[model samples]
Target: MSWQIWFVYGLVALAVLLFFSGRVRLDLTAALVIIALAVSGILTPAEAVSGFGNPLVMLIAGLFIVSEGLARTGVASAVGVKIAALGGRSERRLILLLMPVVAVLSAVMSSTGVVALFVPVVLTLAREAGLPPARLLMPLAIAALIGGMLTLIGTPPNLVVNRALIDAGRDGFAFFDFTLIGGCILLLAIGFLLTLGMRLLPQRTSAPSDDRHRRLHEFAEHYGIGDQLRSLRIQAESALVGKTVGEAAMRREHGLTVIALQRGRWLSSLNPVLVNTRLQADDVLIVVGRPETIATQTTDLRLSDQGFPHGLQRRYRESFGAAETLVVPGSPLVGKTLAQANLRARQRINVLAMRRADKPLEIDFQDTQLQSGDLLLVAGSWSDLERLTGPRTDMVLLQMPAELADRTWHANQAPWAVLITLLMLFAMATQVTSNLVAVMLAAFFMVVTRCVEMNEAYRSMNWQSLVLIAGMLPLADALAKTGGADQIVNGLSALFAGHGVYVILVGLFLLTSLLSQFISNTATTVLIAPIALNLALGLGYSPQAFMMTVAIAASTAFATPVASPVNILVLAPGQYRFSDFVKVGVPLQMLALAVTVLLVPLVFPLTRT
Candidate 1:
């Protein structure tokens, strides 16, 4: 091997370590790879930097915008709501229905995004369906992984393989090219889970768990804050729909405190709440009052229960009512007056009383300026109260009284959201243009169709993932340009010499699958696909066979919680440990492997040439 190949190998090794170490981010590590390759003369400056302009990068960016459109329009959430409604308290039937819905959504949208939409819905559904959350959450995450297999744009790895074909001077795969193999695998997965996977799911644990982390009413009891915490939606027909907190006189007329108003479809700190912030239709108010008073006010005000279907009467008694939380040094709520901070409107907690530096503020608590050491008596769901003490926010939950329930806003556009998603899918499947052009067009339609706004489209793009992919592409280029890919291919050929092509196929599958367990799947694919491509070419077999193996393997991030973001998202909510994944995912991984090894050759044909 030449000096350039040796240098590229060393550089690639260093980059892989940096990726595994988690000290530096994956995107930054990718940029470092680009710098090392260019400085070592492994590639020209333009060659090292060429990945930014790759068509795959544009396709990924455009796809992010398209996904943002579907989310912003509420299409995915709408599907979740419908499916959850059908869950009907039967675990078997719920899994049967829920898994397929999540998979189909993941097939069209980002798998990670699908997981995000489903987690809360799963939490709510688990409560209604009388199942432990852990049982439902793991399946939801797994189904999302399977969903990515069903379409070309289903996941980034699928796109990587198709791009490998195009870069190798072959026709890129059309959309739905993955459907036959991926679909069959998905069906088998569903069946496998229904049969064997049912017994593998976890039951609720009893390790003195935090009650605040449990179901809504349980969380309320854990915090001693019961019916005082309630959610009300300002409907169009309600008298308070267009009124501001101060104008509505909730405190004077009804003895109620408006904690937080979940106003607008999107919110940020830049959009601050004030006393004059008017309530709009569908706005959810986290308010505090006694059961009878709140009920009387809601009846007269004509407010909807804000999607909180839990029976307050059932959990009413046995209350410490509300508790005081101390504000330690450096909370966001510090320094602002009760009127200025608008804790009710801003953080969605009612500040009933305050004691500054151990001295009670018996009078004028509302207008008094907050200090660093203020102890605040607040009321709301345990969940909202817990947020104040979170590492990201200010104020500790006092570890006692805090709980939360699922909340909703702005669901009226759900039909439009679904319609826009279908249109986007149609464009991609038909190849209305190149995948990149179609995505960009669908994204534009999402904006012009009012499914999403310009700013939201901009915000929804996962720039980090995009940069990570773009940065890693240059490393792939360096390998091929420096003869490094050929060397790697030669090594694999020597190991598998005189063996049937299926040997190399399974080898690549295991290699890619295992690497994805630890590293980013897309990164694994970018590095391995080029090698697999060259290896197939060297052995005089169809590269498509090998490329397909790599693609399926890359999506096999089922062995660890860290394998994929989809897994991590469910870890806390599902109360899962690292070993839980191995226990549940290993068998599923084997199923995917058995299916892939047997079916890929039949579909792509190792001897097609």
Candidate 2:
């Protein structure tokens, strides 16, 4: 290989290595590759930055904005609730109902977001049904994967391939051009999964159950305690000393309901709802009613507030302060304890509580390793609080005063915004307007109307995937420009020409599918589309047919966690083991392969070599 060829080969190798390593982020890795390509003269500065401008790249970014709007407006959540209701507290019913809903949503919006939004809801429903969450969550993940193959915009891979074809002077694929085959493959996968494949899933009965009641108790202990109750004492000489809580009329006189009664080493329940409960002397009544009412009842009982220093009493009020902040990934505070982060000393914000990834914090504050998604609670004035949190991506201000850190956020949008995005997507899909202009106009309107704020629009774009697509484009061009593609195509043509186009289609699909499992989807699409086009050119077959096969196979990464980021994303939340993907994905992989082989030739005629 020449130095240029070797350079291109090294770049591809380096990109794949860094992506799978998971130590460096995918976006950063893409940026490094772009910089390397520019410095090496493999691409001009314009070409290096061109990925950010690619039509397919913009399509991905624009769809993200739309999906974020839908997510904020609670449309997705509403759909999730309906599916859960329809599933009616049964695991098998849930799989049947929710899997299709999630798959369809993912086909239009985002596979990762669809799974992220629904996985928790499914888990909650499963817990309510007393089913192992493992059984439901893995199926949801696979469904998202299957759904992404259903449209041109369903996933990044298909869009990347579509753009590659357009760039090569072929008409771009319509939104549903490949949907017939992809949808059939999806149904087949789901059918097999529900009937026979589910039996292959390993049963897991050992996961921790949710303890919502206990969590609620901890919150009440922290926030609802009144100041007057801090000083209420039952002394040896007091009348309350020998009286049982019920006999003393503490519930009636003090207007306090005993939630938990502690007597030395044991706790007694006094709730009238608990049958056959009892009260004992020296037992402390953990009351829930009110503090002012208790103070009035104890006032005639002669309680003394002396003995403890007034300064010592003041310390309780001074120990903690509050501030509102958002959680950003890779923040120093993420996955750290309150004491470890020195949250009080360095930031002067008390660790009151946290909201994380659309869920309330259930982990113990002191013990919880703050992951990337956690929103923090800090104490400070508005100005100082903003000053502290403004630079931190991990912290966003919680605007609701009455709201606890546990509430799921519901972000509503202006209806006009959704209408405008729909109009743009429709025009682009129908070819009434080119996608490049459509996305640009849509992004502009969103900014003007404040649908997606300027900063958010900038932040929301997937720059890494954009860069990966652009960076590899020039390399693919370099290959074709240097006769590298012709060399490979000629070899492939000689080897497979006598075998026929079906064999050639299968060969290209397997190669693209295998490469996509390990590399960036866009990169795989860019790398393989040109080769597929070249092979078709050399063998007198339809390049469109070959290109469509690459597109389908590129999006169909079913058998491994590393096959797609969409698969890896749910791993932690679903608590999925690595083997989970293999168990469910193997059958789907075969199904997609069968569909591609059968459908591509019929759609795009293949001639004899």
* Top candidate by TM-score: 1
lDDT of 1 by residue, 1-609 (tens): 888888877886786566555577666776887787778777788887887898766765665565555444444434445665676777888888988888898888767656755675676567556667888889899999989888888998999999999999966777887787778777887787788888887776312254444444553443344456777877789888778777987876766777555655332111223468787887777666667777888888877765334332212111112445777677776777776776666665666656665665545466666777787776554445556665655666554432223322223444655565566556654546565665567667767767667787787665655665666677666666777766765576578666778788778888788767755788778878888888878788788878888888888788766577677667656766556677778888888888888988888777645
The worst-scoring run of ten residues by lDDT in candidate 1 lies at: 312-321
What is every candidate's alpha-carbon RMSD to the true fold?
A: 9.5, 15.2
| TM-score (all chains, Cα) for each model | 0.56, 0.52
What's the distance in Å from true for residue 330, model 1? Answer: 21
lDDT of the candidates, in the order given: 0.68, 0.59
**Can you write out model 2's per-residue Cα lDDT over 499-577, one digit (the tens) per residue?**
7778888888887777666555666787778778777877877577888888878877765555665655445445554
At residue 48, candidate 2 shows an lDDT of: 70
In angstroms, the error of model 1 at 252 is 5.7
lDDT of 1 at 399: 41
